[model samples]
Target: MKNITDYSGKCVLVLGLAKSGYETARLLKKLGAVVTVNDGMDLTGNQDAEELITEGITIVDKEHPLSLLETNELIVKNPGIPYSVPILQEAEKKAIPIITEVELAYQINEGTTIAVTGTNGKTTVTSLIGDMFSHSSKKGLLSGNIGFVASKVAQEAEPEDTMITELSSFQLMGVQSYRPHIAVITNIYSAHLDYHGTQDEYVKAKMNIFKNQQSKDYLVFNDAQRELLELYTVNSKVIYFSTVRPTNGAYIKDDAIYFQEELICRLNQIVLPGKHNLENILASIAVCKLSGINNEAIIATLTSFEGIKHRTQYVTTIDGVKYYNDSKATNTLATKFALDAFNVPVHWLCGGLDRGNGFEDLDDHVKCVERMYIFGQTIPKLIDFAKKHDINYEMCHDVKDAVSKTAKFTKHGQVVLLSPACASWDQYPTYEVRGEDFIQQVKSME
Candidate 1:
């Protein structure tokens, strides 16, 4: 790793002890920084905290004390922690340089970075890029919001390695100089307004992915959002990706996918479905082409990649009814993509933590939804949507309840889709848990 700054004798506070926070603390301590970790949870038996204590890193668990801010020169916060947190707000007033682990990863990373961010398709595009690299001559280290801690991945990455990172707007907001060599924004839409407080703030947060990029660096953007994205003054070279029309980078023309003027693969050869997935594929192609990856590797990866889990992932077919888990659709736009993928009559399982956003945007997209299985905190909002569309509806306690109810009512050739277009915190702790519950429930029917 490149030693960009000397952290010796610097007092740094790591706010929130999640995986990223734990890794960040360890890395800071390793660099001789005076590290103090603060988490609201009581870490009395936490193995991670114990390990850190052994390394002489201070653990300030149980609560986030305001006093810690007075001593620390810098704050490394977990991405999930909002800036509205009192400690963070105070830090801002104190002129502390607050950042997420993504910034720290960039500061010390020896490898080239390819960061992907968007409302929906970033995870798929990031994973596809990494998968493409794995099948090719080059090496790509997959990390960031894709599950692996960015700082942890950066710690082991070599100079020649390509860091394919799936970044969220939450993570991007804290970045200062975290410029990726090849940045991709699959598509942008209004999301996470609960944390950001406004649509514009959320969009601005996602824009941080390419903020520090130079003219030599590449920004692979979704062509559909050209008007909104182009509003920002990007210093980097813009490479457009479109499933609709020809672009400067990757596009579909004459039934085949092309990067610039060179053919990558035929449209019929792609295994992943949906126009959203096509947008994801286009963005991946742009990044691969910018990285100089061979078309063979791209084609091989594209043809075989079924999809990542919990994002319109097919679980199984029971009695001719196909079940799909898309619990990652934590917003209306994401759910729209999930709904758009299926032409067959759908048992649309949705609703969760309402983020105060209505599902009216999904009015035109839910034409194929034969029935609505609603659950969680946003049940009333989803019920209103179902009523407006004159679709049959059922209220359930949670995802498992919804899945079981849908399974009984679903007819042959119909789809049982668990695409909750709201945050899962209303019931399950995470979307992953909700998705796993949906999968297990569907499997039990067999």
Candidate 2:
């Protein structure tokens, strides 16, 4: 591995002491970079922050110190910190380069990186791609959004290893000169409006993943996302994947997954459900084929690839009523897809912190659902919408109560689905925690 310039004695400001922030500070300190960690919240109860402080890293919490920005030569920013933040604005004015954890990892690795970014299906595609490469002779590292920051993985990755990263729009926003050899945008939908302010801005943020790619690199996108595809101005070799089989790139035809180069997998044999997943499978096929994996390996791996849990995961049948934990559906479009995937009468558990989303798009599913169990901060708005549409609905204080009530209301041949069409921050730390709580509550009924 090439030893890049040592950060020895360079002042680095690490903002937002979350997992990525703390990891950056630790790595910077190890590389001899003078690091000051700053978070806007106190570390009285945060174990992660306490651990970093114990390691002798300078800690600033409760508020971001303007002085920290003034003295720093480089700012390692968490994706959560918007560019509009006063401290970041000041840093920009002073001409200090603001870098994200992914960029830092990219600079250090300087190897082949395959980044996956989209409003939905990114995690599934990223994992599937990583699995394909890992199953083959090539070593691969799976990180970013799915789990672990890229910087942490790059520390251990070999030069020949491929990094299959699931990047969020927020992470892509802060990236500069971080080009991936293979970049895939599965699909774009209305999401994170609160952070990006508008759909256009959010789409632009996702597009940044391919902004630096050259003609030699590969850019995979869903032909279905017409608006998103039209925005790309890069000269990279483009590949399109679609659920409705296309003439070129990767596509599905007659229940079979195909690449432009060869047939990959029989789509009917795939264990993962939903039309959305077929598109994800297509993206994975494109990535695998481009990386030189044979058709036999792609089909074998996908046939055995059980879908990720908490994502349209089947919970159990209690008193003949099936329950699915789709707590990962944190956006209206995702929940819409989930609802469409099932034809049975649905006791839809929906509501959470509203990300400026509306319920109008869900009217078709709302009609199909037997009843709606609304919870979290957005319950009132959902309830109001239901009332206006004459949809049957009830409110619960939390997810457990919602699940309990849903089990009671459901009957034989019916499904109780926890597909909150909004963010889970109102009631849980993450969608995973919310999904786990739902699973536990449902299992307790049996």
Candidate 3:
């Protein structure tokens, strides 16, 4: 693979004018490369793209012209663009190399990268690791498939800096030579199958994080993620983390977090609740141990790390009823964690854009839940499942209506939980937006 420094004076085509795309163009231009930005969205109406155009960067909107590919040294593709796209197919046909924003960022940034990839808990784990490094006096930046893009971090990263990147399967699918010094697979499940077309393909995309790592670099995996263990074969150093104590690597033995080298923390003392967070904590501790961070510092940070919002976040207690905003539970496995964490009579608020999730996994937990209030696009399917299981359920048109109805049905001692096991795109822009909306509705109930 050609290093990014070798691209000086080379013509490059940056496909997709998203933040990452625009940043790639800017970075390439600064490196003395002729950069052209291509996006499917119209620039005449896009304020972001218009601002970039005013800066003298060449912009191609609506459609990508084949001529642009003919003149470029490489294509820095946005992950949102499918590999099956005709333009990309044509680029491949012509033997033009294509890379993702992550690949580009990795090439330019002269620092050790610790990438976190999984079906869930990536953001939480990434943030925790970043916080750990920050407290340890290590210069660290968090970016990637999470809200912060790698381009933003790459712009400021120095040689001694460490980067914690949260990678999605979509972003990983297009990565060429991007390899993290410490790569972590938190866990994997069926997700983004709609884009990948198969579970195997989705897993393969995630596995790419370790594909390019050298033997000296570390690769971390959850012992519980059997699928990942079965499918992955690596030449790099491998470490395992789990809720149960493993003979090697990091694990929970009795109520404590134990590592092959030393004891990390007592699991019982961990402030974060649920078995799912135990896995996340184990992953973070494993990374910190590998980085030579002291056990005391790791424990101190983990104890105070309150966790990210929208993931089982406590909202308010109204008339003795506690409400939790778990609007980030966009899958059955995630919702299962929320249910497992709470022992109270739960007035569960669930349902949204269904991603072909099998509700069968949630059947037993539904019995524990006092009642379910279904909403958004998946209400009918949830209601049908509820009826089949003889579970008490009610459908609401939206989250606001669901919260209002939940308030009426919930007793003073019961917990009103907004753990929607589906995507929020049907009604809200993002999971954070959905969570904020739920908080607003809960506040209005008083």
- Winning model by TM-score: 1
TM-score of each: 0.98, 0.95, 0.93
After TM-score superposition, the amount by which residue 33's alpha carbon in candidate 2 deviates from its true location, in angstroms, is 0.8
Q: Candidate 2's error at 400, in angstroms?
A: 0.9
Mind sharing the TM-score for model 1? 0.98
Compose the digit string of candidate 3's lDDT tens values, residues 88-194: 99999999998888887888787878999998899889988888887887878999877887976887888888878999888887787887899999988887666
Candidate order by TM-score, highest to lowest? 1, 2, 3
Better candidate by TM-score, 1 or 2: 1
User: Between which residue pairs do clashes occur in model 2?
Assistant: none
- When 1 and 3 are scored with lDDT, the better candidate is 1
In angstroms, give how far residue 63 of model 1 lies from its true place.
1.8
TM accuracy, model 3? 0.93
Instruction: Provide C-alpha RMSD values for all models, in order.
Output: 1.2, 1.7, 2.3
Local distance difference test scores for all models = 0.90, 0.84, 0.84
Give the number of the best model, judged by lDDT.
1
The positional error of residue 114 in candidate 1, measured at the CA in angstroms, is 0.7
**Cα misplacement distance, residue 272 of candidate 3 (Å):** 1.1
Count steric clashes of candidate 1. 0
What clash count does candidate 3 reach? 0
Per-residue CA lDDT of model 2 for 233-291, tens digit only, reads: 97788898877656478987777767874666676778777877888888898888888
